[model samples]
Target: MIKNSTKVLVLCALALSLFNCSSDDDNDRGNWIERSVFDGVPRSNVVGFVIDELGYMGTGYDGDDYLVDFWQYNIAGDYWVQKADFPGTERSSATGFALDGLGYLGTGYDGVDELTDFWSYNPGSNSWTQKADFLGGVRQAAIGFGISGTGYIGTGYDGDNDRKDFYKYDPTSDTWSELVGFGGEKRRFGTTFTIGDKVYIGTGVSNGLYKTDFWEFDPSTEVFTSKLDLDEEDDYSITRSNAVGFTVDGLGYIVSGYNGGVLNSTWEYDPGTDEWEDITGLEGYSRQDALAFSTGTRAFVLLGRSGSLYLDDNYELFPQEDYDDED
Candidate 1:
């Protein structure tokens, strides 16, 4: 039988200790913060790119229909503004890359047929102009990356077969030329990111199985080099397709997608050492076919499908910090 005063004092002490522990746990978490929700309808298989200081995302499938409406995001303002609709037919799984301050989007499946029509967007004018068709012909689910002032796109299903051929697009000349094919297996839905002059492409589905082999593309030499395999021996479990990737401060990160099921794991890639290390997964919904865009300082993960649901939320990541979600 303890006195009421003695019991009250013990409870107060316990509360104080818990508060201190909570504060310490928060400090250990990663710098991923939820930003304003995307203004567009919930969607997946979207395309995104950063131009100047702003980011643009559009052209994806919403559960029932293909989407063409485009939206621009102002990072500093934390808001989205709708721009003109994509001039091309409604489509999804399109590939896009930003080069020379302009964004290029092309090659996607449009419900009835795979398409190769290419389009360019100008942020300064908020207008889109059709560009030269992809030399790879009508295809969808390809990968695109920008490096050394040129845009490169390739590899996807062409209604009948998976492809590994690659092409280079010259904005200054408005031309597309064939380049060396990817070194890995023919794949679609792979994740790609460019750091300095090198581009990294990996983790996708081919034939009937998921692929974990990674490749590094050097624009200068126009060659594709294999990196450490994701399935070699280590615990490298960050394998999936329909995922998205972006680079911040020269480091690349791949976020949520589908393997045999919806995936929520996150991974970081180091180009200098050609190594990948697991990071904390996004605290938001686990999804696949999401859109990713990175400015010089920040990276974002947005719109995608989770099972039968479409998501329109956006998450920001500070790669330099540790990720702690338990708190």
Candidate 2:
């Protein structure tokens, strides 16, 4: 035979290594555990923000319908409740971010046309108010994030073309300003997240090729630098759109996007080594247009679409990085 014993040894060692690494820093700090996954408005291309321990998800499109309703997820009570509707025209694929306790939402296709209107919500006030427009043209399928009260939005299609332009919004001044280019190829429907002072961008389809290139941008330097590359072979290729990525502390996790159809695979990136690890595929049906954001280390995978139907299923993923107990 081809030495079945040798094969067993190799497989056992590989499994042990994964277990060790997951417990390497485990002093049993018990960081990053999911509390709940709420069933919100079942739709795709939705936008969301995390504010003061509460999470808000809203706005997206279906096959033949668009949406404007909003809902707030209560982490403490493990429940979801309807919130003030988005004041803009009902739409899908809009970008959203939170800054200084205010939730900012803007830009999306409203069935008939893409939009550029911007709006803000204050949970404290239980109301939404209009703000300056996005400055950029109407767009959907872009990513938005905030760093130190400054919001950044860009990288989506504008009508018939894809866009990579980035703009900075200052909520303090209630204004928008252009920033340096993203330094990545122009593509719509990727994923992005802000960690510390830098924002990271990753995989999306453009032209006809699926990309695994990754980059980081510094607000202080106003420049982008290539940092990491994520690649793997699976039933799902990198070819995808409406992907989702979120950050807790400085670690980033990406998952379940669509490539012609829904994708179930997921990946995580660590800036310390500029490396990515393929984690468990999402347990739910493969989907696209699901939006995710994290207040603490825990991340939630909410609703999206699979076959020909919209979904309301929510999944809670725990990135538990418990440090090892030396005792």
* Model 2: CA > 4 A from native: 1-41, 232-239, 321-327
Off by over 4 Å in 1: 1-29, 38-40, 324-327
Model 2 lDDT tens row, 246-272 = 886678877888776788676667788
TM-score for all models, in order of appearance: 0.89, 0.83
Candidate 2 accuracy as TM-score: 0.83
RMSD of each candidate?
3.8, 6.7
lDDT of 2 at 157: 80
